[model samples]
Target: MAYISVLKLILSVYCFFTLFILCSTAPELCNFPAIFNFGDSNSDTGGFSAALFSLPPPYGQTFFHMPAGRYSDGRLIIDFIAESLNLPHLQAYLDSLESNFTHGANFATSASTIRLPNRVLPCGSGFSPFYLNVQYGQFHQFKSRADFIRTRGDIFGSLLPREEDYLRALYTFDIGQNDLGEGFFRNKTIKQVYASIPDIINQFTVDVTNIYWVGARSFWIHNTGPVGCLPYILTTFKTAGKDSAGCAKAYNEVAKYFNLKLKEAIGQLRKELPSSAFTYVDVYSVKYSLFTHPKKYGFELPLVACCGYGGKYNYNNEVTCGYTLKMKNGSEIVVGACEKPWKRVNWDGIHYTEAANKFVFNKISTGAFSDPPRPLKQSCFNPS
Candidate 1:
């Protein structure tokens, strides 16, 4: 009888310790070790600027106090995300000088598209050569080289990620806007652009799968924002029909269609990759809200560029935000930025101001603009 009693007591103690350990280890919020970002200008920290020419002053005036290689006057959405998660800002993969890959890397670049452009940068148009597939290739090389270098156990090892960090890392994507933009700029009709979406989405799916094959498990994919509301679009497509919010109606419809397809693809991916957690962020809705009700969000002139020259939208493609032009009287004059960039939504007619990016980040980080309604902190947890 004493032996049986002792056995029961041992079992009880074991159960108590097991429960305590489980409860203690259970995460209240996701603990992401790193972030691997892929996309276009929206998330490009300095990829394009490093590959091409360095952006001039006033580009990062609002926060960095100098040119920081970001398209905005200050920080980008990805910058805010890294700050929220207590991770260091990701350096561009293309940036060879002073780059540390310990946390993660950003493969995004300005004018990047899902599909490879017909002509690359400084050619037919200003499209980036580092498209989605190229970015994946770069990532593949990075992973392999990182492993090879870490085996040496030198100081370089400390500047690279641990093998397990890739599995726990959050993979972020904010691409595909340029695909639609490409179709439109190439003189493809609205119907033609719509027809091209399936192929665009297929490429996106393939790229995501490629990343997954490389051991990425947590995904935070942001759908493209409302391109129709951009000052560049509004200024260029002058004949397009306008919505109640003064945005291009047909262009927004195309964006909605693309978003719908992307959502569906994510749902399929969830079922296919049961071990992975995919979070679809509806940035389009949050951005559209800013345009519709600018005053509600403490913004004015939602459609105008904070820095540009000429035209009704204060944007002229011939003379961009930072260009210096020689006057007919033989005097040099810089275009310069607006006095108050924080009060405006658009920056240089193509990107958002730092203030606008922060606002969008605030809204989406709450999970209100996310599909499955999961906050960014809990993105690794799959919804039951």
Candidate 2:
């Protein structure tokens, strides 16, 4: 009902379609037009702060040079995707004051769950503006605004995207970790969490279908990464027994099961939408490699939390990675970033460092992490 600026979104979508028509090289994929992403902190651009928490200093100190609510020190996987495509990084939809939508809008937020009924994380709320369903609602609003401008052709002029343009744009989903996280945090075993996989993937499938009905045919859905390797999970769920890699076996097993179900759902969805390109990104193997084979990737301690203060894992689950606490001995303990964040795998116990993000992105774009085997650009461009 209110006036929403969707010019950036429309232009971005339209430009991507133009890219597909223009470029076709295997090495340089300048042929990318735009991407619409829905996910949690892993791909969040700044939705966390725009809608909820304000990430403080050292969060973006590595590359952004300031705290941008990114939950990381630099670019995220989504940022790398945009960089690979030669598109401007997307702006968080809620950060409208000085936001630029030249590329597209990011509807992701920190601790966002795929299904709303699932309990919200202890750090975040459960409902509107954070769930994928809520994000989808916002996207519907975005599409409507784009439709309005294109139909009227009033003030936006040529930047408006035709309806088909919006339909053809790439839609990426990197959510679901928090949904399972809720269960794990509750002390549910991996087998217990497995029972919810079907419902989770089913809800995800419904959301994808909702977008497909609106014309989005290019889908890049990232399966959950290796959550057990996260410092937070390792610390919170550690037992006497440990994996050979020192990572939590239960959490990773949960991730594997979820990914398997997600892949199957995508396979079935492919049959449902024969003309659409639905690629499931295998981020687990890529991310897990950083832990299992840290030396090969130049990481010294892949299991250590890059920013945890005064803890074995560098992650004080009780204290997070920001702010300070007063101790019993009249001493104050503060949480902050690591000195060598670039060389570490995990960031703040939960997310990955920028260096790790780039590594995963590189592997994914190599055409190996994707199903149906093709570079991300080719899959996006050729949805047939």
Give the lDDT of residue 70 in candidate 2.
Answer: 91
- Could you tell me the lDDT of residue 315 within candidate 2? 76
lDDT per residue for candidate 1 within 77-168, as digits (tens), equals: 99999999999998999999999988899999999999988779867566999999999999999999999999999999989889989988
Those runs of model 1 whose alpha carbons end farther than 4 Å from true positions after fitting are 1-27, 381-384
Q: What's the lDDT of the predicted structure labeled candidate 1?
A: 0.92
Per-residue alpha-carbon lDDT of model 2 for 247-308, expressed as tens digits?
87777888899999999999999999887888889998999899889989888788887777
Best by TM-score: 1
What is the lDDT for 170 in model 2?
Answer: 73
- Which window of 10 residues has the lowest lDDT sum in candidate 2? 120-129
Model 2 Cα RMSD, 1 decimal: 11.9
